[model samples]
Target: MAKISAFEDLEVWKEAVRIGVEIYRLADLSPLKHDYKSRDQIIGAAISISNNIAEGFEYNNNKVFIKYLHYAKGSAGEVRSQLAILVAAGRVNNEDYEKLKSDLSGLSSKIKSFINYLKAFNQKKK
Candidate 1:
């Protein structure tokens, strides 16, 4: 594998950024556009996913990176929950909801897998 010298080189961080962009686009649509609180919250959570990953990577320590990874994972979950709420309120359609959920789920899994990899790497170094 190529050495990842920046957070942007990480697949997980890329996915998080994609999700954030998609969420922002969705929020710009009709119903979601009017829902200020939910829109802000969902946007914040989506952004947090990428931000946490970047922040953690910048720390340059396995333990600190893992701690930020956990935060990123949690933010992914928060985005899913907020998306569900939007779906329930008719702010988002079923198809969009399903796609978003699937995307977030995949992102969450990627984060978890990376975390596990980091843990194993740390253990091996000990």
Candidate 2:
């Protein structure tokens, strides 16, 4: 495995970035464009997922990184929740919403796995 020296090199972070871009694209479509509140909130949550991962990795501490990973994971969940709201509000189509929701859910799972790995490694070092 390649050494992960930066957050951008992380698969989880990359997935988060993709999820964020997709959220923006979805927000640009139809009624979401007019719903400024939901648009901003969803977009912010999506971006936060990747941002937290990157910020935490830069901290150079596994514990701190894990904390940030949790934040990112929470943001992913938040985006998924927002997607459901947007779909129910008729702001997003079923197909688009399902795709984004799946992606966010997958990202959250990846983050959780990474956190588990870090926690295990930290425990081993103790």
Off by over 4 Å in 2: none
RMSD in order of candidates: 0.7, 0.9
**Sliding window of 10 residues with minimal summed lDDT for model 2:** 1-10
Clashes per model (N, Cα, C within 3 A): 0, 0
Tens digits of lDDT, candidate 2, 1-126 = 466988889999889888888888888988899999999999999999999999999999999999999999999888888889889989999999888888887788888989999999899989
Model 1 CA deviation exceeding 4 Å by range: none
> Which candidate should be chosen as best, given lDDT against the real structure?
1
Worst-scoring 10-residue span by lDDT in model 1 = 1-10
TM-score of 1: 0.98
Clashing pairs in 2: none
TM-score between model 2 and native: 0.96
- lDDT by residue for model 1 over 1-126, one digit each (tens)? 476899999999999999999999999998999989989999999999999999999999989999999999999999999899889999998899999999999999999999999999899989
Best by TM-score: 1
